[model samples]
Target: MTVAGWETRKNVPLVGHQVLLQYRKGTSGAFVTPKKVRTDRDGWATATVKATADGAYRYDFAGTSLTRATTGSADFVDVK
Candidate 1:
């Protein structure tokens, strides 16, 4: 199945916000492929990942001239 995630601010959808999708493997590997995505009309950002080991995923919002930086929560994936 495909995995997806979203972003919001102060209960409002952050439409067109830039999000970076990242992943790290088994608590040892560095994060890779900071995929760029723009928030949709509903503040949603989605990424598709194929994993070969257990790892954690996170999304980062690099602060822009007008927007402060923030990070999304990390979720772990156990690949079989």
Candidate 2:
């Protein structure tokens, strides 16, 4: 699967920063290991994740730069 998002603060994109992609199998399931990716000039970052099984999955982003930390969630993904 491919996870992608934009990093912004106060409506401004944060460039050259790192964002972590974290995933879990189900709503009540524990999250697996996370993947780290860097934001491009447009503040967009993406990570490729390999699903372990077919199920409902969720993902979120975590990032910090210059003492500022941010977290954002993406829409759920259904893997077959």
Candidate 3:
């Protein structure tokens, strides 16, 4: 599975920042930390993982000196 998202604050793109990719199995399941990636010039980070189970995917950017934008777990996919 490929996950991608933008790290932005006030509509401004944050480049070269660290981003984390996470996944959660079936509903009510605990989330698992799978990978970390860096944002590109466009503040976009992407990660590809082989899906082993039906779950959700989301990316998060930890706050940095560059920006204070942080994201919580969001549902991007629901595999049935």
Best by lDDT: 1
Residue range with the least summed lDDT across 10 consecutive positions in model 1? 1-10
RMSD (CA, Å), each prediction? 7.0, 6.8, 6.6
- Which digits, one per residue and each the tens of the lDDT, describe model 3 over residues 1-80? 11233553335556777888888886667677799999887767878988777778777776765456566666756444
Clash pairs detected, candidate 1 = none
1 against 3, candidate with superior TM-score: 1
> Which stretches in model 2 have alpha-carbon errors above 4 Å?
1-12, 54-68
lDDT of each: 0.74, 0.57, 0.70
Query: Best candidate, TM-score-wise?
Result: 1
TM-score of each: 0.70, 0.57, 0.68
State the TM-score for model 1: 0.70
- The residue-by-residue lDDT of candidate 1 on 1-80, one tens digit each, is 11133353235566787788988878767787647888888878887767778988999877656457887778899987
| Model 3, runs deviating above 4 Å | 1-12, 76-80
Model 3 residue 23 lDDT score: 87
Error of 3 at 53 (Å): 0.5
